[model samples]
Target: MKAQSTAHRVSRTLLFHVFTAACGLLMVYPILWLAGSSLKGPSEIWRKVYSLFPEHPTLENYINGWKGFGGVSFTVYYRNSLVYTVLATAFTIVSSAVVAFGFARIRFKGKNFLFACMLVTMMIPPQILIIPQYIVFSKLGWVNTYLPLIVPRLFGQAFFIFMFVQFMRGIPLELDEAAQIDGCSRGRIFWSVHLPLMKPALFTGSIFSFYWTWNDFFAPLIYLNNPKRYTLSVALRSFSDPSGLTDWGAIFAMSFLSLIPVIVLFIAFQRFLVQGIATTGLKG
Candidate 1:
């Protein structure tokens, strides 16, 4: 019986490792392929497609991709994306955390009802609201500008608010009482006491906001009419040419480059990020 149990455990461990390795390879292959393709010349990309290593590697694609075809520079698009993403993400974190704190801590009439309504709003598809939002922004002459991207985040987002609220609920009310007894005001209690405790949740929210805003294509596409206002996602679209001059190598290089910021953000906050997600589910 002991021998059988040991054999069963070993078999399970082996199976788990096999599954993990397979999944890791599957996730990594596309990134590897893109990196290899980015180094290849246009002719080498199409002609020697099956080869994992480029026969003749070159950095010309990166140079050209950054510069432009005729008058469409990717550097401008990258700058626009960085600006919009940073501001929008910062606004989202602050607004969402404040709103979440109120929902979780403050006593108010219709608080439960309002929270219910907010949850229902989360269930509703964002696509349905885009048309109305576009109409309003257009009427206000905000199209072709960054306002459309940044302004909406100031009002507080539902998902981040929900995540923050859940995390705040997991923290004990005793902390608030202790702060209050020490003559701390509500603002100070939140800023000095609760805010430090919320580091994990804040890191998680900021990372999500950064990634989503950085990679958002639809919002930029609808609001930005000018090539100069394009985000990386939107800029990638410009690479598709019907004139047979589209540089797939450069497109792949820039696409991979676009992913680096999100990766760095994740790696930097990996510790807090893991804890945040775990604790979010600990409360109602």
Candidate 2:
């Protein structure tokens, strides 16, 4: 009876793993198809639409895609995206941390009301503010520039601020008290103690901020008028002509290339992101 029961458990575990593997493959099939399509010859793509493997792989798509339109290569667009994303992410991290630290640790009048107001902002859709933002930026002559993309991040982003606040609250107050006892000013305590302990949360925020800014299409589409100023997302869109000529091969190639940075960033920081999110509301 013991041996029979053990065999039954083993069979159940095997079936469970088999089922999970099948589900994972189904979920990942689209991405795998995309990757495969990027390597296929344009003529073969539609013909072999159902096939997971490419029949005739070539580098021509990548080469042509990199050449780009209007005398601008993808290199320029990639550089612009990197600069825009990095600066925006940096500003978001610093600004969010500051605001969150204030709300989490500092005591002041009207703090709760202010924090509540900020929380309310999180519930509001960004689309509602786009018109007002556009008008304001246009009046300031900041349209068609990276300013429209980067400057808004300098102000505290409500979601990031809330995320940091939750993580900061998980940290013990004893550290702050000990720092104070050692003659550390609030700023010094924040800089020397809180910042170091907040690495996991900071990394989590950085990953999110980088991903959002890099993938942002609407803002860049609205603000940037010049082809030279286009980011990867916008440039990728230009490959499709509404007149019915679309370079599916080149689009697939560039789209695959555009995914590299995001994939690398996520892989490198996924550990910290998971840790930060898992521990967010837990007391240390």
Candidate 3:
């Protein structure tokens, strides 16, 4: 009976692993297909729709995609994207951490009310704000500029602010008390005591901010008028020909290239993300 029961457990575990592996592969098949398609010749792309391997794999697609349009290359698009993403991510991280610290540690009049309002903003869809925001930015002569993309991030992102608040709450209040006993002012405490200890949460916020800003399309498209100022996301869209002359191979190649940075960043810092989220949720 003991041997039979052991065998039964082994069989179940094997089945579980097999099932999960199959499901994971299923989910990843599309990405695999895209990567495969990117290497195919333009004529062979549609010809071998179901095949994940190219009969004549070539780097020609990447070469063509990098050449870009209107005398601009993908290099310029990458630079524009990097600048926009890095600046926006930095602003979000700084603003969210500072605002979250106020909500988590400090006591101020109307603090609860203000925090509640920020929470409400999270519930509001960004699409609803676009029209009004465009109008405001237009009136301020901020249209067709990076200012429209980067300036708003200077204010706290409600989602990141909330995440930081939860994570900050997980830190023991004794740290603040101890810092005070050592003659540390509030600003000094934030700089020396809190900021260093908040690495996990900060890293998590940064990864998220980087991904969102890097992949953002709508805002850049709406604000940036000049082709020279276009980010990777916008540039990718410009690669499309509405008259049915689109370069599928080149498009797929660039799209695959765009995913690389995001994948690398996630793989490098995913541990911190998991830890921060787990600790924050438990503590909050």
**Tens digits of per-residue lDDT for model 3 on 1-284?**
99999999999999999999999999989989989999999889999798899999999999999998889999999999999999999999999999898999999999999999998997898899999999999999998789989989988898899998887888999999999999999888888988999887788889878988999999999999888999999988888757757888999999899888987887888787677557656321
**Per-residue lDDT value at 224 in model 2:** 94
Tens digit of lDDT per residue, candidate 2, span 7-56? 99999999999999999999978877878888889789899786878887
> After best superposition, candidate 2 residue 78: deviation in angstroms?
0.9
Measured on C-alpha atoms, candidate 3 has an lDDT of: 0.89
User: TM-score for all predictions?
Assistant: 0.88, 0.93, 0.92
- The local distance difference test score of each candidate is 0.84, 0.88, 0.89
What is candidate 1's TM-score against the reference? Answer: 0.88
Q: Judging by lDDT against the true structure, name the best candidate.
A: 3
Clashing pairs in 3: none
Per-residue lDDT tens digits of candidate 1, residues 42-146?
A: 789999776668988998778877875448787887788899988998999999988998999999999999999998897898799999999999999999988
User: Residue pairs in steric clash, candidate 1?
Assistant: none
